[model samples]
Target: MDKLLITRGVQRSPFWKFILWILPWAMLLAWGLYGAYLCLAEGLNQTNMDNRFAFGLWIYLDLTVIAFGAGAFFTGFLLYILKRHELKSVINSAVVLGLICYSGAIVVLMVDVGQPLRAWFTFWHPNVHSMLTEVTFCLTLYLTVLILEYAPIVMKNRQIRKVPSYLVFEFNLHKLMVVFAGVGAFLSFFHQGSLGGLYGVLRGRPFAFREDLGIWPSTFFLFVLSAMAAGPSFVLLTTWLVEKLSKKRLVKRETMSYLGKLSGVMLIIYILFKSVDTLIWINSTSPSSGFPAFEYYDRAAFGTWVLFAEVVLFGLLPALVLLRKKLRERMVWLIPSAVFVLAGVALNRFVLTIQTLALPTLVFDEFLSYMPSWQEVATFSMVIAYGVLLYSLSFRYLHLFPQERELTQPY
Candidate 1:
């Protein structure tokens, strides 16, 4: 069968190496599936999560992926709404990554819920005031937008294009893509913000709670800005990884540089707001609630270092590095800076999810910690494996790099 995602003039490794490339991830996938089986067979008893730690590693991974995946919707908005034609080169890969992240998160969420059988109750019961509900509605709807975004790419396959109906449908979808992109951006903005709202509204946890602006907390806007800041960084990192693994230039240096600039600017802005938010929390919110700022940082594992890393090293440092014209243009500096930018977002999610739970709230409560059981780690590994396999398949089949066919031509 003809491949759908291989680049032009690029020859893949031998069948043996191909098998080797997949073997480890495949094993991880199997382990995750086995864990899922146990979870379904035995229930949440297989994991370490308790009533206090109701949202654990699984939720952390889900929200983090969704936040990073914001590149798809944001990039689409730039390309379709703002008419940023230069972004077209990387848009296809962004869409692919978004589809994988969103779908993978939804899958993990299904397993994470206490009553997996009653998962639909979230929608059916409809807790209108709950932040979780808003997350559910937007996530589900935006996932549809991602699917629509990915459809044309799938249809563009050499073999798939041979089907006339598919070709026609693809063309129609392409024409209407602006509308889909608009809907996706709207949904992404809400869901990404709501993920922050998830922690913000937890008034029971002084560490996570925040003062509201109207109905939503300051973290709500901070999350939206943070996700936007990190989204392009993730896309840049993913593309760089793809280029390294494929041993080909998948996108122009200028395009990567532009994305770096965008991410850097947003990161700087986000850091400023985050700093203000932290000061306000420490001075007003925490004090009013009868908790000192140091009280939350009292945990041995989650100390002041987390804050430093998230704010200074991973946050402001990367922003400074990326914003520089000299550094953004150099591949050596560019790749590592992109990595740092991505790390900052991951750290942000970690502080919000794990740190919030790790901090003792009630006077009788003690600092808590959690390590995912083998079952939990396995389930998480499934997502990584799935992403690798999907990206491999897409790279093997789709024209992800527009310059490929032009760069490698037959005489």
Candidate 2:
């Protein structure tokens, strides 16, 4: 059965080894499901979130994963629209990662909403004024586009491709992929911006509030830039990890270097914009709102160092490393640079979601702190287990890396 499903000419681990490898992740997924059930069945009370900290660990996870998932649309945009042929090597893997990240985020969101049954109310009773409404619509549409993009990959599986009708479907789907890529990019741009806009519009939380740039806030564009920068790095990191785990040269060194360079360039642009935004917020935005920017950092657990880490240690440092031909060419420096890029993005999201909520808004109010309950931690853990399991299955069955055979086999 395994042999029938596996792609021909590619060697996979023995069935027993595969099962052993997946066993722990499967158990973790089960535990996570149980935790999710507790959240949905009992109430959001099962988690540590409250009125002050309504958006907690779950929201942070959603933002981080969505940013990491940006690789799918950005890579597609490069390959199909700009005609960067080098990106074609990793495009399929990007699509799968996008699907997993997005679909998982949506699942976590449903549980977080605390009323899964009433989730349709957002679409049914629309709120044109809300950034969240825009996010909801774009996220759904983008997920659909990702599914369509991923379909061709699934249909290419060994036994699946053997069917005449499936082959025809895959062929037709390939032709329309560029269109989907365009739509996916459009949707991703808006939703990614809207997520940031959601926080930026918070007048009550002066720490998060940013001045409007035309109609949208500064964070809107900032989020889009940061996600674009982090996306390629995430893809590069995952590809390297897969290569190491499989002990196969899945893609050429040139492809990896290209990805690193792209990420580095975008990171530099993002850092520039972010630095400008920070200066503006500190000098003008926060001051105008009657809140000193330094005060926000003066609180417990969050300090000026967090900002420095996000901008300099993680942002500028990694961007420099990735941009350097000598550094990015070496695996030792390249992998850590990618990791730092991701960490910077995660820290940005953490500051937005956690630190924003922790700081007091009113003069009378003191600083507040909140932590995730076991249920929240488990539910989030579920997403990681799900991604690993799904990727493992896809790699075992599908031709995820197009260059694998050519790179490994004799000429």
Candidate 3:
């Protein structure tokens, strides 16, 4: 009975052991739900967010996961659209991770809005003029695409597939996957850019504002590039971690190398544009707006060194390492480099959201400082717990690793 649900030929932890491990994640999710309840029941006042800081940790986490979740569409683009058959082994895992990340972020957004029920207003009433309005539409639709992509994987379970109807459904879904992938990639590109555009179009806040290129800002293209760069590295790291956890080789090393190279190429392109954008903004945009580029650092926390670390330590370092065949091929080098890449993208989101709000627009208005209320921390932790639970369960029961059976069975 215990083994019935586990995929045939794949070994997993004892059922009770799995249950014990899941307990912690479940508890955390419950705690987070309570925090979300407080936010909804009491108000957004429950969070550290204020008029100046309209966004908080939840928005930051949303950006982080959404950026990382770019893995799903990008991988599908490589495998199905580009016909990179070598990626087949890792694409399922990418979809599962993407499903978790996208779904969890959507859930957080629901809670962050303070009235989960009113979320439909974006779709119903429709604010065609607002970037966030566009973002909401794209995210909601793309999330549906992710669900469609994920359904066939879930329906592949031993017991679920026993149903002839489910078997037929999943089979047909797989056939139409490329169409879905194309649509997903299309939606993802626009939404990811729009999310960045949300901040860039903030002409009222010079720190956050950017000069628009036609309709979109430089930040628009920068976001799309950065997301593509981070997505592949995240997929590589997740696949590697799954390998360590399962004690099995789930993907060919060449797949990892290929992903590293892909990521490296994208990162170099992103960093170059990012450098040019920063120079243009500091030289022209900031001064024209009467906010000197250097004046941003009047608040000690947003020091000059942050720009260097974001660009050089995290951005430049990872791109250089991943681009090198000799270095990225080694696990030791690949792991840290991938980690730095993730950190770099995450820091980019943080500065874009938090630092912009923290800076004082008026000389008399003090630079605002915020520490997240416990409710905010718990709410964010909830998403992390949800992701862990979903991924662990999917890995345990689904044939997410196509190479699992061959690798686990003796040659």
Q: Which candidate wins on TM-score?
A: 2
**Ordered list by lDDT, greatest first:** 2, 3, 1
Poorest 10 consecutive residues of model 3 by lDDT?
A: 113-122
TM-score of each: 0.96, 0.99, 0.98
Q: Over the stretch 1-411, how does candidate 2's per-residue lDDT look in tens digits?
A: 999899888888899999999999999999999999999999999999988889999999999999999999999999999999999889999999999999999999999987888888999998999999999999999999998988899999999998989989999999988899899999999999999999999998898999899999989999999999989999999999999998999999989999999999999999999999999999999999898789888865898999999999999999999999999999899999999999999999999999998898887887888989999999999999999999999999999999888888959
Tens-digit per-residue lDDT, 1-411, candidate 3: 768878898889898899998999999999999999999899988998887888889999999999999999999998999999988988898998888888889888988886777777778998898888888988999999999998999899988999999999999999999999999999999999999999899988899899998899988888999999999989999999878876788888888899888888999999999999999999999999999999997678989888988999999999999999999999898888988888999999999999999888887878888889999999999999999899999998888988778877758
Per-prediction CA RMSD (Å): 1.8, 0.9, 1.1
Global lDDT of model 3: 0.90
lDDT (10s digit) by residue, model 1, range 1-411: 443344446666555777788888888888899997788789988888988888778988997898789899989999999999989999999999999999999989988874677877888999899888999999989998899989999898877888999989999999999999899989988889999988898888888899997889988988999899888998999998887886877787899999999899999999999999999999999999999887677677878898889999999998999999999999888888888877888988988988888888887988888888888888888998988888877877787777665545533
Per-residue lDDT of 22 in model 3:
92
Runs of candidate 1 with Cα error greater than 4 angstroms are: 2-10, 114-117, 409-411
Q: What Cα-based lDDT does every candidate model obtain?
A: 0.87, 0.94, 0.90
**After superposing candidate 3, which stretches have Cα over 4 Å from the reference?**
none
User: What TM value does model 2 have?
Assistant: 0.99
